[model samples]
Target: MSQPPPPPPNQPPQGGGFGAPQDPPPGGFGPPTPPAGPPAGPPQQPQPGYGYPQAPPQAPQTPPPAAPAGPPQQPYGYPQGPGAPQGAPQQPPAQPGYGYPGQQPAQPGYGYPGQQPPYGYPQPSTMPMQPQAPQGRRKLNAQAAIIVAAVVAIALIVGGGVMYAKSSDKGDDKDTSAGSGGTEGKNDNEGGEDVGGGGGTEKVPSSTSAKVLFQVPAAEVPKKDVWSVAGSWLTDKVYAKSGVSEVVGYDPDSGKESWTLPLSGLTCAGSPEITKDGVAVVVAEDAKRTKANPYPDCTEVTAFDLDTGKELWTKSVAPGGGEKTAFKEVSITGTTVAAGSGLNGGAAFDISNGKILWQPKVGSCEDVGYAGGEQLVAVRKCGDYGNEKYEVQQLDPKSGTVKWSYKLPDGIDNAKVISTKPVVFGVDSGEITASGATDVFSLDDSGKLRAKITLEDGKYEHDCGVNAVHNCKAIAVGNDKLYVPTKQHEGAKQYSRVNEIVSFSLATGKPTSDRADAGEGYEIFPIRMDGSNVIAYKNGPYDKGSQVVSIDGKSFKETKLLETPATDQVRSAISGMVPKSSEMRYTGGRLFMAEDLISAPYSADEKDYAAIGFGAK
Candidate 1:
């Protein structure tokens, strides 16, 4: 299939490391744009439903002077009404899908040129509807003579700090050996015992309703810059979140800070996977930011125990004693810690001792990022600028050996690994959708492509972070299926919009008939898989509180797990944490949500929340 080329040689570098970032719309990025072309037919305007944000009100219109009565002249030169004889202002075409109740739908010209988002497609917005942060560093623009030049700038400009900071993995380096030893007191089971998927320790409660346990206030940041707080995780007893320059562990039940693991600088990226024993990895800067170096390179990699808040080891790579190597993301498969970059290549380290296991030399090819869990998968970039190709490879976690590799089609600039075990990933073939994907490809164990599920641009709604491979939201994988939420559409109630969670089979790449509905004013999205079942979140309309539910993988039945308070304060707190851009975890009847980036407040009265936790008895 023909895919969209990356920014032309003359264009500036886009921000995403997986691909390149496109600047968000000026007023703030809204929903995905509708696909190009007209809809099959006009549908009724949809009203804002539960869970979705309401649109801002418009200025009250002043009544035009009474029209002169001459053969019933049209009023104020307005177009004839749809059914009226003439000169009656026609009602605006029903807004696409669900719209803010009583609010005028934004006129066309925002997303793709179209009549409306088709069934199963997303409706674009004219204004910012949700609070979100970019996954990668802010994209900067540049001028170049050709597409190749622009592509090169992508590495130099966007790759910036990361390009200068990759660590050398030469076997003879004394630093490699010196940094491999653990710094903290060692535990007997550190390397010997297996800790499969670290969560799922708490028991489910009988009552599905929940109460807010606590809310963490955000730290005051400089008005000129935003700080990255990109990671959060849940264990049986602790919920860990990234702070300014530390990872704080809070008692899950009381929301009190139990422990803090300080870092050399600001936290940049974190591994989503944790060992059964609560060991995880994060990337930070080698030094704190200063006016001279407003944005320090993220070079420090630390492995720590989440439960005890113990720092096992911290290491940074500086090839040939040059600038320290910086990493944009990290992952763990078994005991191997894999850190990747788009410009300098990638390296794997021993999770137990921080030993340099392997660091591949950068040539025409580089490992851009990795998705780790039961398998360690790398998305490698090869070829030259303007003619680059991407290959997805399954690697041996300990040895960094490529077990198998699958090449993406040419012209496809980016891809994200959604699931490693099932070997499923998404690609933005034409770069036409806001979700950064146009199709999903599923592969067999041998790396043979099985089925391709077309998203048809914005027809389906889902998101995988631009810079990181494993940072996907509103999606779940289980029972040989991939689950995604449909775009919101009109519900049974007047002015109400709702959405549903549907699944696509990995073996066939076709959507199954089953669906879990969010009912009349809610939008349902999957969080993660709990065994064969899917844990989901339902965004409620203004009057109702949001909910967490578990959907049976086979039957598609939903069991309510928890619901937040519907009071205005609680509603604002819970609804403001959108799943697409927020760090969220729901495990063992406990739900935690946090922001990825906290910027200076826009106004004095505006409240800032860093994180919030909820629990059921």
Candidate 2:
């Protein structure tokens, strides 16, 4: 996994796990009151850090005879350059290897421990060391833990699940509609018309400010147990969201429920990218849950028309006439739909028909997962349970042949594919950071390593789930660069913290002074790439509402696109839906946030919405 921190504004801070803070419960849409600090002083220039310049040396000063060279008088314990804080207790290095301060080791030999890897790969430590973490970030760790615990306790006692739902509401939603009208084919909306000058057909409205178009209330849960409803997309004619055992299409502007395609079982996985012809696929179980089998295998793949709510095809593969392969994930590349599973290996199918394109031969190696879009990349696992190895292979979409493969180093517990076209991914070695990955790797077209970006613990924020290889958020790759937001820090205003989105060149793996400020009390997170621009979400403060902004990829200038309402009712409804934890989609002057799962609410008065839509007229 490769992602970052907790909530902003009303939400509690995140818990510290793996050096970086893990995701915490949802908080207020506005920032909480920070602790009071010392008296104000003259503002200092920003110090150089990774992807930024190095700090200049102070002029040689004449100290009093016998005076000690005390630490610099900076307040927040944030060290600027190479030197650690003066007089601070010295801490020993955790791992000693190729990457050390001023150590120029020999070129790495790309070989695994016992054999020639499918593709030779150097040891993980050959990567560069991340910049020293700020002590200020360290201090937040303890506070975040305390805040998260308190928030959780309050949720359990008060019986307000939505309040604590901020912490773990990562599940999808169930089917049901309220106050929606209209049916399929009645609307006049047409197909793709890429507006807003980007990759998708997202139109930029004249006014950035927005109003709630409509909302879908949470459906009653069966047996009061959580169920996955994890899929959402925006086509020209419809805004579709997955529900319990069904997929619903709604008019994008009017929020009218147009049509519904019911399913036999729950939707477990969904293709993030829809075809240019308005088609997408989702993985569902073959049968409904029963008393004898509360859990059903996710074995069915269904492709449907996003515009018309028409099912194009539904297919499943039972390898060797054995049990049906239970797939955990699915992705799309061109006309091919790929699904992977650690248990049954992986298989590909034609998007147009239910015909099988290819299926893996029985072997020790299993296709654990895949990341697909401009290309198809599979994450394959081999060896025994305790001692496993992983390989990232770029596969031909139609043929399912490996074009290039890169073997990950030993001791890597997990990895997530960040981008397919540029072949970028993140690796977690446990020794570095616990929250997903500590380093990101970019590969050249030949599958050779290009550059590695070290996400210093607690410095950058992302949400790459522990298991899903393609389920990553708050991170974007475009223009041959990676864009990630920095952890929140003391803002220019009193008792306020802010964060900014920074870019790293994939070619050089260096920070390029490219930063987009999130402003006071606001944190900006990259959602995805639009054309050459970065579509970002800005979490707002108590009185202000969250916003969607378009960041110029080159100039780093921000264009505000959509702003939600700031009223108490609307803010509370929007507060719990963070971009990383929830299924959030924005395009054509509209933004929709849907829950990944749904369950019974704690109290009668509490409102638990399955999805909410907002638009800027």
Candidate 3:
């Protein structure tokens, strides 16, 4: 590039110039002077083409009006353009379009007229500013709705799974056919074919194989009428008794007497019990003696051989006799015999050879009994003045070794032990109230309690006396049912009426029947599983003598069997009597009942009664 030329000297070299003054004074040149007034003449006329009138020369003007204040102007330098005033001095151009000092630069893309270029290059014209969409509110709403729907679906699936699990846990598909008709096991016919549409090919259950082969005619006792009948399965013989103290044996098949053994100085009072081995008879006798010498007046238990009426052994437990005992209750099993007495403590005897096995240390006992299978069970009440309490003990039947013992509640006046297959059921009486209470306890083989069912007198309110056996009555266990006879109070006369029969489910322990209602002055004993039909016996509604009535155990409907004529003598003596097994004996597959009938003579009113038997056909 070519360099520019230097300025002239009169201009003071371009930008450094202070040019010479335009005009000067004429004097010594020390300073300029003003011109005198135009020569006194007519005003100078204007020239034709000059455009302005000229001043007439008088003297030179001083110093060109004394230059304006500030630095002198330079020639060939920057000119004061339109932005600057006409005669004013010019300032330096603001450093190539920069603003004044301390002023901020114009923002990029938006600046004053002539500024340097911005830093970033220009962008493409086709690129839009992109209007910054509103973040798609509709899409966000849709996403939120999807999350909520998924959560609800998961909740519903989990709830359905939980319900299905609960239903499956209950085992709803289990077969319930065994519980039908309140019976257990299967039903079949005799010809090995499924009977009653049961699935099995075997017609009948093996348990029904042994049907009733035959039944003998009912036997009648002589002289005093029949009081009770005891049968021996081992000898196929039946023992019958009347008012007399002798046991008369009859053939079960012929209904004829085989032998009559006289009981010397002893009278039968309670039922006889047979040993589990079916070899002996346990006969209870009440001696003829007064309470002053009640020890000698106590009861005696005699064991006799089943084949011959020969007495094998005798255990005399008399009140105040040596031990001052009064035998109240007696029960015998395979290897043991339990006897409860008034004074002498309850004792166990060896059934093989009549010998005292063991005696518990307790007061005089009232009712003593035994239950359970191989493990012998003994239950008894001790104490006098009706303040009796019960004790349950498990012992070895062969050696009389006490395995365990449990003390019952203080109020229990009486107790009975019931031995079903897997458990021992204890039905006990509460304290000496007028009606008393019944408590049922289920015990394991180890003498531990499993469950309890307590029946209070106030809850059931039976009108029986405190000592009545029918207050809570007896419990009989059958195939699938438990029959409990409960005495409900009808009126003021206590212990004089037949009350109710309550059947409870043996499996579930729930009441199965409506309370069975009985008439006034009647007595009932519900018995089931006697070969074919379930039966119950009812006595009385009699004005004088005893009247006998029977009912179907399953239906609770009544069936009249026999009715004896009424007599005033019998009415004054006997209160009531019901049929019962003499010795837990069954003949020809029929449960033998011992009937205690009052022998009322026409001339004298007597308190004596006879025992007899009625064979169910």
Candidate 4:
């Protein structure tokens, strides 16, 4: 290492470091030279290798080994420091730079580019260097280059921070690359708008104009038969059951005819239930069919592929002598579709081959339906007719054997099952009375009584064409609780007060949220299920009002989701006033749910029909 030329005569070396004092620079160490303009950036690390306050001074020795020849190209990684072109002719070495003993060569400071040296500092040598050993030059250049790289790296990082801060201040996304998810908002279909999916615009309020997916005009089909329409996202089509012995399927996306298959000498015996695999329906052999008695003949079961309109298979089902609708209610599981008859029994048919799977010894006493996910469940009269015992049987689909059975308790006074999931809701005899036993019992998975609730004063059982459990608007499950319509049962305590819509916890049968809504004379009925909430339709005595409410299941908060179908024809269809000729659900879609709003074309006018819509947002 070269000695930093010794300090002039009288002044003691100012502690071995870069600022060591000289004896008055031919005059005196007057004022310390100002660091050329404030530092261009955060303080540079004392020019790496320069002697620190504690570092020992270099021992007197020959000058540092010369840097190798064959000049290295300017580094390509970073923008060059401002001054001369990066590769400009190397200025002669000035003050010695600090580094491993013999590694670094003396060079001008790169800080404050283009600035003159501080007073008393040695001037950069204008003389060119003598050629030296290539190996030695390489070592010297690499060490010096490292110090330059460090300063460059720090500058770039600080620059990046400033850029990001500026972008945020401008209220734009910082990520500027394509598909960087920097856009704000989205179409209604791409919801989460706030919650799920991706970062986008907030969803429009329910009051805003809805983007209609599709609406089928009423004039195309008979007004009375308008409601036979049913839709399913699984099958991706709108389905309708014509009483005249045929089923029509329409594409949900465009409302075009997907396919229409005839029943061949049979009438729709009951409302059909559809699954992605196929559609299950009960029909009557053409014999006893009449305008008044739709299924007066014997029973027949049919399965059709809504995807292709091909008849998968058909089976003759006779629930036995003179029983009504022996093949009425249809449900599907795995590969088997089962149809339950009035009282005779339920028969499971192979969904693919139409072969009978199995028949149970004991048949469901009441209408048979599905329960507990894919299992079949029904209320069956177990004891002799004189004694009359009723129990719910969870049946095995393969052999029709009883998987488990839960019997109704005595004094419960005739509780019939209404829903099988979320919770087992039973409709007991008569409206809620003071002395009456609990008409509604919430049961857990093991069939244990979880909680008991009574009905409201005016919430009596009524036979609404669509849903039989009219006391409650509709059966909706949210946040592990079953929400139902209930009035303050007579003499119940404050904790049990469920005025309009009551939430019964499926696990414990306790009231979780005070989630109920209604205005005078107009009670709220949950008509549709949204994510984890229920969309409610406010129905009063005379007509269906134009208020659509949504209740959050978790919080039990209610928000006006949408205005009721505004068109009179659509309103009439929703109200169920006009006679619907068909018996099917018309509304269907994935991102959206649409329905034929009117039962038929408006007869008073000429040809006009409508439908209502509700969806993701």
Best by lDDT: 2
TM-score against truth, every candidate: 0.69, 0.72, 0.46, 0.51
State the lDDT of candidate 4 residue by residue for 1-617, as single tens digits: 96432211111121221111122122211222322332233212222111101111333355444434675432111123343234332321333121101212234221222322222211112112121113222211211222232223222210000000000001111110000000011122332213222122223242332222333332233322212222222233343333234555554434456676676543424322345344545454444334564323335666766666777777764333223233434555556666654333456777778887754333324433433223456555443322344566666666667766666532222333344443445543333332122235555565444444333223421112211111122444545655555432221222221136656455433344454656544445555344455555444322333444556655666665344333333333333321111121211112222221223222232322222222212
| CA lDDT of each prediction against the hidden true structure | 0.59, 0.61, 0.35, 0.36
Residues 1-617 of candidate 2: C-alpha lDDT, one tens digit per residue? 85522212222122211111222234423445565763344222222111101111232345323312663222211233444335432221333211111111222212211222121122322323222123232211111122232233223321112321111111111111110000001112233332344433244565667877666555665433556677887655677888778999977766668888988788877888777677889998777877776567788899998878999989988776756777768888888999976444789999998789987666667787888887889988776544567788899899988898887655564568888878888865344343465567787786766666656545667767655678777888888888887777777788887778877677655565677889987888887776577778898876788899877766787878789877655666676554455677776666788776655554334445667777775
TM for candidate 4 is: 0.51
Per-residue lDDT for 192-260 in model 1, tens only? 111123222223455556776665656666654556676787766577888889998877766668899
* Candidate 4: segments with Cα more than 4 A from true spot: 1-243, 264-273, 276-295, 319-325, 360-374, 383-387, 409-416, 431-438, 460-473, 486-499, 518-523, 528-531, 538-550, 559-565, 577-617
Q: Is 1 or 4 the stronger prediction by TM-score?
A: 1
TM-score computed on alpha carbons, candidate 2 = 0.72
In model 2, which range of ten residues has the least summed lDDT? 177-186
